[model samples]
Each structure stands twice: as C-alpha cells, then as structure tokens.
Target: MSRFTSICLGFILMMVSCDERDSNPTFSHDIAKIIYHNCSPCHRPNQIGHFNLLTYTDVKTNANKILYTVKNRLMPPWPADPHYTSFVGEKVLTEKEVGLIETWVKQSCPVGDSSQIPALPTFPIGSMLGTPDLHIPVKPIRLQGNYTDRFLVIKVPFEVPRDSFVSMVEFVPGNTKVVHHVNGDLVRFEFDKKKDVYDGSLVDNLVWDSTIRLVYKKIGLLHDDGSYPTLARSVVNYLPGVIAQKYPEGIGGWKVNRKSAFVLADIHYGPTVDDVWDSSYINIFYAKSIPKRPLQEFQLGTLGVSSIVPPLIIAPDKISTYHSSCTITNDISILTINPHMHLLGKSFWAYALTPEHDTIRLIKIPHWDFNWQNFYTFKKMLKIPAGSTIYIEGVFDNTRDNPYNPNNPPKEVHDNNGSMRTTDEMFQFIITYLPYEEGDENISLE
Candidate 1:
C-alpha cells in the first residue's frame, strides 16, 4: 500500500464522520419545537399543569423529564382511545417525532441554530373557546389550614319552557388553579332550593333542615355488607381536564322537563393552601331537542372479588389486578369506555375477547392520574358482537411515594361489604353504549 492511497482513504472516512455528526439535530431546535407546540399551553405560567416549558431554558433544564413523559405518553395528556375518532387539539405525537426527541436527549441535548427557532405557541386564557350558554358559579369557600378534600354542590336553577337536550357542557373553573374537579347532575324536581347545597352534607344545619338528602334513595345498594350505603357522592356529570369526557352523540341529548331543576356539585382538593378561598363553577350547553339515539352505561365491577367481606384493603404502592367479564346479550354500539378508580389507582386497561378467544384492546392507561381520571369516549361507535366477553384489568399503588396517596402513613385498602369505606378501594368499568338497531344514532355525554 502506498502513502497516497492511505491518505485518500483517511480523508474520505473523516468526511463521512463529519456529515453524520452535523446531521444530528439538536434538542434546542427540533426537539424543543415539539414541546413548545404541544406542552406549553397548560404547562406554562399560572396554568394547571405543574411545570412550564415556555423557553429553551425550560426545555433544556428538564430535557430528561420531558423525554420520560413524552415516551410514556403521560405529559401531553390525551386519554381517549386512539382507535376512536380523532379530536381537535390532540397532543399525540407521531412515531418519528417521538423517536427524534428520544434520540436528541441521548445526544446530550445539543444546541442547534438559534435563528431556526420556531415561534412560541399562544394559549387561550381559559380552556373554553367562547362564552357558554349558562355559567353557574359557587361562592368562594375557605379551605382549612391543612390539606383537605371537600365536595360541594352548587345548585343552578334552569327554567325549561319545554323539554330540552344538552349537546356539550363545560365546567369553567372560577379558580382553575385551586379547583380540582366538578360534577353536575340533572334532577327532575327541586328537592331543596336553598339548604346550603354546595357543602357536600358537611354542615349539619343544612342536612338536618333540608328536605333533599345527599344520599340517593332510589338506587338500591349493590353490596351485602353495605359498602356503598348512600348515593351522596354520585355525580351525574363531571369534568376533569385530560379526563373530562364528552358523551356519545346520542347520550348528551337527555330530556330535561320544563321547570325542572339541575344541580352542579364540584369536588376540590387543596394540597398547599390552608386558608385560601376558592370558587369553582360550570357552564352547560343544551340543544332544543333530543337526538335520535340513546346512551347507557354498563358497570362491570363493584362486585366482591372474594367471599370474605367488609373493608377490602388492596393496599397502596402494590399492584393488584381485578378481573371482570361482561357478556353482550344484545347487539350494541359503544361510544365511550370510562375506567374509574380512587386515590390508590395506578393503571386501568380493558379489552374484549372474542368467543373464539381473540383479544381486542379497548383502552389502556399505563400511568393513571386520579386528578385527571375521565370517561374516554370513542370518536366513532365501537361495535361489539353479541355474546362477546369484555374483560377489564385495574392496578393499584398504595405506597407513600405516590403523590396522590390520601393516607398519611399508607395502609392496605380493600373492597368489603356494600360500602366503599375510607380504608377500601373500589374498582368499576363504566361503559357508555347505545342499543344497536335501525335509526340508532350517536350521543354525547359531556
């Protein structure tokens, strides 16, 4: 081999290496652009999300955290099933984009050209787009000096000249930062016009004098030991961002009789503030008439997993999977699948197994957020064959490390008796489906 030949080969190899290094996109430009477009809205200043990613510094500092959240599909929280209809403002990233961010972070988050930086996205003042049909507000309530969870019901009087239907409803938080969640229900009659309805039966004066009791008197207890004694906490309508669900098209148009009354109760958790006053409210959007289809929910769980009864402690920080099967007796079109769990819930997934034993993935929440738990409505109706077996699985974490742990020193929780006591955990898979028939249409459960 001659010296000239050796030099030429060496030069060629150096050029190739330089090209590869230069083509490696930096996190500052390519990666940061994705985060700013998708995350900065709520995650920015004074928003509900915990952190901000408004600038290059913010993205650079939390590069690894960003990578983790995006990889897990937890940071840009869109909970609906991807197989369903697509939604506006979805935070889902393409496979290539996710790969780019992951690879960029591994390369030490290199800084690309500053001039190539994209413009930052502008977020709305609130989650809603325009003025709502009806805005219901709750008087500012003072919080205890310590972390406390309180449920309040604010009655909103609606005078329906005739029967009407609701298409879309949004809970506009008077104080978004402090207001944790909101649920609204439409009742036929006015049980109590004014009995301090907003205070979740906490005030003795209101409960004793008011004709309306917090507990649901109609729905009989499903359990034997009385674990779920009263329907005091049952929310007909609820909105929790990232989990705030929209009813199937036919579902939202339920009839509200003339002069009928509806109640909006909000659930709030104040962790940091001890003596802060917070106000929360909701706005409902109604249509003049009902839709063509009707919506119904199928509850699979709340059944005892064991014969041994009362105070079923599943324990925190531990993984416990519960199994339940439902057979579709009649042909039905499913609009949404909502998996419910309390503070100790870590993840919930549901799928359908054909009579032949083939598996169909329904919905999967690998990392669950109790604060953002919601009804995941499919964009399109999911048709299940009659006699199909629907399977559900839920995992719980009761450890002290979980931020949502309600217990001071976490203990074992279980599903015992009929009631869901403080020391117990409840598992349920609530699905919204429409009866299959001709002229059957979609409904919305907003």
Candidate 2:
C-alpha cells in the first residue's frame, strides 16, 4: 500500500469520529440550556434540592440519577395530571427532550466546545418579582428543628394611602431546607403611619391595640370562627415546588387600603435542620391603578376533613377515602387551583358541576405527592356559571406501604390535632378566581 493512501485513510477515520461528536448534543449547546433553565432553579447550592446541577461537572457527575428521575417524571416534580387540566407553572419535560437526555448520556456524556455555552440565566437572590414596589420584612422566625412540624403565624405590616392594587407577591425563605412552605393573609388596620413606623415591637409600646391586636378585617376574609371579617384577606402562598405568582396584565390583582395593611404569614416548618432560622420577606408589585377585575382567593373544604374520626380521619393501618364539596353562589372565573394533603395522601380529584349539571374537569392528580404540589394556573381562565357546585375527593393511605408516614407502627392520624405535628392529615383545595363578566371566558391568566 502507498504511504499517501495510508495517510488519507487515517484522516478519514479521525474526521468521522469528530463528526459524530459534533452532531450530537454537547454540554455547551443542548444539555446546559436544559439544566440551567429547568433544573438549576432549585438544584443550586444552598437550595432545598439535595444536589446541585448548575454546571457540566455538577450534572455529569450525577448523570444517571438525573436520567432516572427525569425519565420517571420525578425530578422536575410537577404532579398535576396534564390530561385533566394544563397549568401555568408546569415544568414537565417533553418526550423528545427526555429522549435527548437519554441519548446524550448513552454517548458517554461528551463535552463539546466550551465557547458555545451561553451565560447562565440570572435569578434574584430572593424575590422573583423584580424590584418590588414594597419590601415588608417579617420578624425572624426561629425554629428549633426538634419537632415533626412547626407553625408560625406572624404579622408583617405595610402601609397604603387610600386604596391600591398589587399584582405580584413573593415569599423568600430564610432557611430553605428547614422551611416547608409559607401561607400569608393580607390584613389591614387603621394606623396613623405619620405617627409611627409600626416597627413590630411589643415592648414598652403604648399602641398595643394598633400593633399586636387584630385590626380592620377585610369584608371577605375568613376568621378562625368561620365568619367573614371586614379587613383581613388571603394574600399569598409558597409550597415545596411552588414559588411566586404573577397575575396577568390589566385583569387580576389584590386590593390594599391605607387603614393598616399587614401580612399574616402562616409558615409551616417541615423537618428539623439543626440551627434553623426562618426570617422571610414579602415583595409586592403595585399596579399604578386598579385592575379591571380583582382576584379573590377562597379555601374550600368539608367539616369532615377536619374531624379526627369517621370520613376525615385516617384509621391506622388502613386506607381511607374522603369527599368534600362547595357550591358557587355567583358566576366566576377561576385563575388557578392547588390541592393540599399530607404525607400519607394517595390521590386527589377536583371538578365543577354547573347549575345545568354539566361537569367541567378542573384538576386530577391520580398520584398525589405532598412535596411537589403547587398552585397551577390554568392555561386560560375557566368560566363557571352561577350556582355551580365544585366537588373535591381525596384518597389517603395510612398503611405501612406509605413510607413517609412518620409512625413507626402506623398509628391513627387526625387533622391538626390542635398542633402542627406530622401525625395529622388535611384535605382542602384553594381556588383563585374573579367575578365573571361579559367576556369572562375570553380572559386568560397565562
């Protein structure tokens, strides 16, 4: 064989190898984009996620775990049944995307040209709603991390002149690991801001009634007694997989008043992390003017859900199914929906029945996961005519099959049980809606 022929043949083999690597997804162009956008949000350091997937080294080291979790629909953690209803904050990967990941991993996870990698998408240190109009900080909530669960209800006050509207509200946790989720109620009271800053201190203060005591309860806000107060209202929420909620333009917002506006955050601590401290803040995005329609939030559930026995209670070593319903008295447009359950929950279904008895499927999670649940905004606003009754049904498994049940021997569980212990269970769903108008069906909270 001629020497020239040998050199040409060797060149051809090297070119083929390079071409195969180029055609496939490289760490720079394909995989990095996917990881940065989808996985890195919670996977970064100091976040709730157990591991970081921020860089090529970080992801490549855990490539197999990533493949298994994403392929099994476990990593991104969106549990809403996509066939029943589509939502706004969905993070599920497409089949094609998942396929690409599998193929890339099978190719021994090759790294391509570094220059092709794009700049990492920036995330705010705390609030996702950029440059909040108001920054109201809550007093540092200290958690000893010794209990199964801890509940802290603190009021962080903000001021308004007359009446205003806010479009976005975000809760930033102090310790993400120790904090499970936070729910806040926006309440207002009559306070002369010109007179005092309401620094949230109770020591050596004369205005105890104006500061610590309950003030102006909003007209629709519900009290513990189940009565609608005139001044306090449900404002915002954060869950394991859920973050901040931003409303659509010119359509939905929460109204605030000058009288005395404060946020009551009902923070629930999940597991104990030694030296846990949770000092969170709420950032508000104020609209220049009132929106076309105001967003209202309602917590709907059944009395049996809170009961320690019968349908509401989970009998030890057995599976239980419970049902709850609420009828709509007025025409409304639903913006979002979120179902809440504890560790032993198995499944959940929520639907609406119109006055004519036409059934509208709202959401269905055949396999309910407590840690991954969030407020799922509808792709478009859902219109339910007046006199429609919405029903929610859930199934709970209290047996040993459920690994998350804290009970070593699987004991009977009750709701709240007058404490935040994990032994209890809860059954409820929250809906964000606005009063239906002529073009209600046309409005989209995308």
In candidate 1, what are the lDDT values of residues 391-427, reduced to their tens digit?
7777778788778777768777765433423235667
The C-alpha stretches of model 2 lying farther than 4 A from their native spots are 1-23, 145-149, 160-163, 191-232, 259-265, 270-273, 303-310, 355-358, 416-422
Residue range 1-446, candidate 2, lDDT tens digits: 79999999999999997666445877886788888888988887767787888888898999999999999888788888777778887888887678778888988888788878778888668676678877877777666757656655555655666667787777777777767777666665433322332533411111122222332232212243444324534567777556676776776676776644344534676767465777777788888677877777786653222222245767889988887777778988888887878788899998999988899999999888866668788878889888888888888999999988878799887764323333467787888888887786776655
lDDT of 2: 0.71
lDDT of 1: 0.59
Off by over 4 Å in 1: 1-23, 26-29, 71-74, 78-95, 102-116, 126-129, 149-157, 160-162, 190-251, 258-266, 303-319, 397-412, 416-423, 437-446
lDDT measured at residue 156 in model 1 versus the true structure, 0 to 100: 48
Question: Using Cα atoms with residue i matched to residue i, what is each candidate's TM-score against the true structure?
Answer: 0.71, 0.80
Candidate 2: 10-residue stretch with minimal lDDT:
202-211
Overlapping backbone residue pairs in candidate 2 total 10
Best by TM-score: 2
